[model samples]
Target: MRTRAKLSLSLTVVAMVLGFMVTLQYRQTLLARVSDVTASYTDGRQKELADKVAQLERVNKDALKRLQNLNGEIAAYEKESAGADAQLTSIQQNLSRYRILAGTTPVEGPGISVTLMDGQYNGVGSVSDYTTHDWEVNYVINELFTAGAEAVSINNYRVVANSGIFCIGPVITVNNHRLVAPFQIQAIGDPAVLKGALEMQGGILDLLRNVEDIKVSAVKVEQNIQMPAFTAAVTAPPSEGAAQSTKSSEGKQG
Candidate 1:
């Protein structure tokens, strides 16, 4: 009986130890499973964050491309605007020069003034031979132009491209305005050149003083001479299309 009791006690101790070992192994396995689940959840969260970062990078690249394209368009527009401004400036300059040449605006510069007077001689000669004529005035004007005169005026009346000069009996008519003796012709040009040209051998001055016996005196070189604008109505030459239209209207009226 004693021996059997001893063996039973030993078998009871072994069975308790085996049960404790089994319980410890089961708890360890449960902890390992929980750790695996936690690790899997963290990996999933990291993957989600990485995917969002990749998507943002793609969006940023697309935005950058669009911005670059907008910049290119803006640059091209600026270049075109600059070109248009330059063209407009050039056109304005050309128009200003044309207006100056047209003599529609008043001009002031250095030039010379010529005064022609009828002879005061009381000799036996016709009155017409001693007095100034329209031809003499025209000749002086022509000479001034040939001597590189920029502007010319007779008795303060601006002479233009279409100006007319004729004689009305004892009076000289320039631009339809009557001018009497002691004609003052103001010309804008190099004073020396103008004086030299008029005083040259057998020039207009000589013809008036010697041949016609008219008194041509006093060529004053002035530093500043102001010329008025041509007040006469400027008639523009009709264009071909306008002339044709006018003819057509006349035909219809007829």
Candidate 2:
């Protein structure tokens, strides 16, 4: 009886071990099948993405080629246009310069140039000239323009553009540059019209001529003066994008 019981227990243990082994092998097969399906799906997606990338690259290449062609066409057009207008522009510019250099242009209209200098002072009751510093010069420039001079310059430097009527010590500043006495002021406008607008008629010019008097000359010169170049002028386009960015380009190109 004892032997039979031991034999039964041994058989039960073997059956249980075999059942667990089969269950583990089935589980492994299921995992392998799932892995194969997942890998196939991933490979399909990767291939699709690669094809899409290839299409986009082709499109970008085509766009760049078109841009280059358009740029070449534009260059040809500008060359032809510049050739057409070159002679006219040059002729006009030469004429303007010739007029200026001839001194036919008037230095002033009807404005006064009051000069102030650092020299011997006239005593009390003695009506003499010569007052120094930046204030006097600035006062005269402003007054001249206010009195109807279209433009004013100290020496050759234009005081109208980014120039200050400031002073350092005895010298006056015109466009940050120092200028000494006997400053030549050039203006272009109606001389007679400006002369009537002066605050102290003969006072400014007369002071330079007589009292504390320095040499200050004001005469109306006919204005054939040429205007200066503007800092921001229209410029040529830089790149394909630049041409495409403008309204004019769109209208013309479209």
Best by TM-score: 1
Q: Which residue segments of model 1 deviate by more than 4 Å?
A: 1-90, 120-132, 167-177, 236-254
Report the Cα lDDT for residue 27, model 1: 97
What are the Cα lDDT values of the candidates?
0.73, 0.50
lDDT of 2 by residue, 33-76 (tens): 76864666478777688779899879966865675576457556
> Could you say which candidate leads in lDDT?
1
Range of the 10 consecutive residues with the lowest summed lDDT in candidate 1: 167-176
In the range 60-167, model 1's lDDT, one tens digit per residue, is: 668656755774575566565556587765765565456547665567889999888777644344545423466788789889989998888878877764544552
Per-residue error at 78 for model 2, in Å?
16
Flag regions of model 2 displaced more than 4 Å: 1-133, 161-163, 167-177, 196-202, 227-254
The alpha-carbon lDDT assigned to residue 251 of candidate 2 equals 64
Please report, as a residue range, the 10-residue window in candidate 2 with the lowest summed lDDT.
Answer: 227-236
